[model samples]
Target chain A: MTRTSAIFRRELSGYFTTPLAYVFIVIFLVLAGVLAFFVGNFFDRGQADLQSFFVFHPWLYLVLIPALSMRLWAEERKSGTIELFLTLPIRLSEAVIGKFLAAWCFAGIALLLTFPFWITVNVLGDPDNGMILAGYLASWLMAGAVLAIGAAVSAGTKNQVIAFVVTAALVFVLAVAGTPTVLGLLQGWAPSSVIRAVAGASLFGHFTAITRGVVDLRDLVYFLSIMVAFLAANAIIIDLKKAD
Target chain B: MLEIRNLVKKFGPLTAVDDVSFSVPEGEVLGFLGPNGAGKSTTMKMITGFLAPTSGTAVICGHDIEAEPLAAKRRIGYLPEGAPAYPDMTAAEFLDFIAHIRGFHGIEARRRIAYIAELIHVGDVLHQPIETLSKGYRRRVGVAQALLHDPAVLILDEPTDGLDPNQKYEMRGIIRDLSPHKAIVISTHLLEEVEAVCSRAIIIAHGRVLADGTPAELAARSRYHNAVRLDLASDEAAGIAAELQKLPGVASVEAAADSGQATLWVFPQGGQPISDAIVRLARTQGWPVTGLYVERGHLDDVFRTITAPDATGNALRDAA
Candidate 1:
């Protein structure tokens, strides 16, 4: 709807109007490159694929997505623009979805800026471009899921730093829940259904599953469901807290 | 064009807006008056659909705020307290966004943005970031955004809060210009503002309506209504007060010496016209009267007399 686009345009431009967009993009590119080439040992593997570039996306997103989405709602509340925004002739869902789409689009832009990684692999050897493209798709999906979590947490507080820290902590727990160490701790006593539920909620688990060339419907469903569920909660949280 | 019916808002155990209700027809400018924490802003929020009421609802142009918030909101323009706006956005950008959400786009949006900018005197600062603009300009931008669509109902909370005298006067001029076609509700701590623009005034405290009437009607409730103030050059404060008290319609007289001159305030019985009788007495007695005038009462006194000092009175009412 036109109303939603209006909010989307304002929120997206809000990033560029300040140093937030440039600084965030700069940090995102530098960190993603360092993690992929230096820490991730992209050349050391030399398997004619971007396995190194794709492996660190979960860790990359855990920190970067929160930063991108922190000010989406928190700054609005702090600056008192949220009241003006909500009182406009639009539904609460429109504002929520519009702001989320802006933050997600910014994340997509930052992810797209990493195309040199893809280009480097293609020119260096006969890499499976199909697998690399799949990796990018998986990363974008996981980033959307992460940004959704950040948006929900951002709605509950007016402090952007608090939103960032709390979102980081919450997503960190979700990403680590399906690790062998955590599952080992839950085994022998916890029910298998509970363990499966915990594993299904692990963002890194679903993220890693989709990076191996073929996109799975279950993985797509998982990411989309997280987006829908978290965004719905974001709307409700903003409604309860907008009056604050 | 606007009506509120028994609107109540309670925050946990404390009630922020009690059973308060009022309506404003087209062409009427209602001045909402109350001290700090008097539920004026809370009521405005409910009417604007920013906060949901615990009990009642507001109807804007026949659209119930709770039943069809989008419809009601479309018909209302609200300038909240402090005139909050996006700090990072330029004034032009902010208004353009508002115009877009108000359903105008492209050339129509640009045309409206220009017109509202001119009407609000924010033309020069249209490209400046709102945060960088002066307080007066920022407040005008707030008013400009609210006036973008020219809704039937306008709710402005302290529209001229931080402006200078000239800006405040201009702001009042704008309100006077717009009131002929719209219903307006303005909340202020300035009694002079009420006298200048408001057709009717409502005083509230502890989330309850204390008094509602025309500005003159509320002022006439003051005890000083129809009273006379006399400034005499002579220093006989006591003797003249006694003589003035003996006038046929005079209820009581009190005189005080200021800078070696005596000033007397003569109250009339039942607010009768005692000025003629006092003049006759002063002339017959050949008193050294330098200045004399009858008082039409004052809004400040009426407001003070009607509102209690604390929440105890409201709490008592709540208990019953």
Candidate 2:
């Protein structure tokens, strides 16, 4: 546990020491705001909640999460510091969890910085603060799931660009898996069970369910299972590919 | 207290390290010598638990590297090839991180970092990021990181590779100072380094151990061991060469190309000292010998002879 904290501290501080973290946070905030008010038609809908703001989170994280995770393992491998890291007394799982948590915390910090949107809805009229809080929690969880997938993909190669591109493509597929466009296409030929399963597996579906002010146990389980499954995959991939 | 037993590492059809085995007791500095791509780094990686050996194990302080890697790794301070470190980190921060991972914390970590920085003479560059430092400073920081925890075993791969002569001397001094309590293994291609700091030496080639002995013992394997070389003013090279060969216990005499002065090298049949006999012969023949010396043998010659492509037969012949 001490070793994990040491790695976590080092990795967390690593983000703040560079301009990348500030740039990523600013871009995430500006893009989320613009997408919610302009593209999301928040005032036009006359909504008293932050549904518009929370709705853009999956898209916002698609670009930003990959940027955060591309360096987790790829940069370590590229700089040859992975040699020093792995030879330390820490276990493979500890290093994996430590790094993943650091990235997750950074994402959470960026998500929390968008609180003004929630405040705006509260000031305009009586809004469901409970739903807004659930939206924030679900947003953070979904971001963790995306970042976990990014972490696993990052371990497969030493090129940050490749990690980023591959992760973005993968998250895009997961985000669109349950949408009408994808389900409609699958409904034409696939079995009903296959389409339902695909719809159930969609990140967009679980995220939307939580944003509706109803946090189901199954929805929570979906996000948690994604994080756990991908994080475990990340550890396995790192162990198998570390020596290469 | 390190034992490496028949460690073999094969990557596909290429065997990077093959049946290489050696041990280092406390207070001994073992110099690992080999030509490039001869598996020196590969062996070190396997022993450090950075890479899994295809079929063998290394025991460090009673822990098997393959079975109990974390325990084994805790007792070892390894400097991998190229002295890899986080480029963006300052030397102080980097060392602190290493100290923490090695189980030091708070004031204890700070004290150890200070001690190691001063010991390795990296105090001046402690605040500079490793990427901004010169190659020598970066190398020193890498060394300091390895020594931060003061493990019982030190496995350094080319520690003095990029250092200048003075820094190399200081590094050797540090290794020597710490050698009494720790088992040290340093891999280097620098032949003189083995003689300078190593208490024992192992020469590997083609992923196999070719020779293991003290510096003097390995140097004695040279064909020129105990040979005599004479620089005389006389120019009758062929006549003198024949006479030198006829001397008792003399193996062969090779004369240098005819210059204004004559130079002849006389090998002994059994590495016997024939300098006095040659001096007497020079006096009787009225030949003025300008210079005379007995060879202690050259390590460069021995290294080349032992690692050459046809070295197996030549090595056996030389041994005979």
Query: Pick by TM-score: which candidate is best?
Result: 1
Interface RMSD of each: 0.8, 0.9
Per-candidate TM vs. native? 0.97, 0.95
Task: Give the per-residue Cα lDDT of candidate 2 at B275.
Answer: 84
Residues A189-222, model 1: lDDT tens digits: 9999999999888988888888988889999999
Top DockQ model: 1
Q: How many residue pairs clash in each candidate?
A: 0, 0
lDDT of 2 by residue, B89-189 (tens): 88999998889889999999999988998889999999998899988888889889888888999999999999999989989999999999999999999
Candidate lDDT scores, in order, read 0.91, 0.90
**Positional deviation of residue B261's Cα in model 1 after best superposition, in angstroms:** 2.2
Docking class of 1: high
DockQ for every model comes to 0.86, 0.79
Worst 10 residues of 2 chain B by lDDT: B311-320
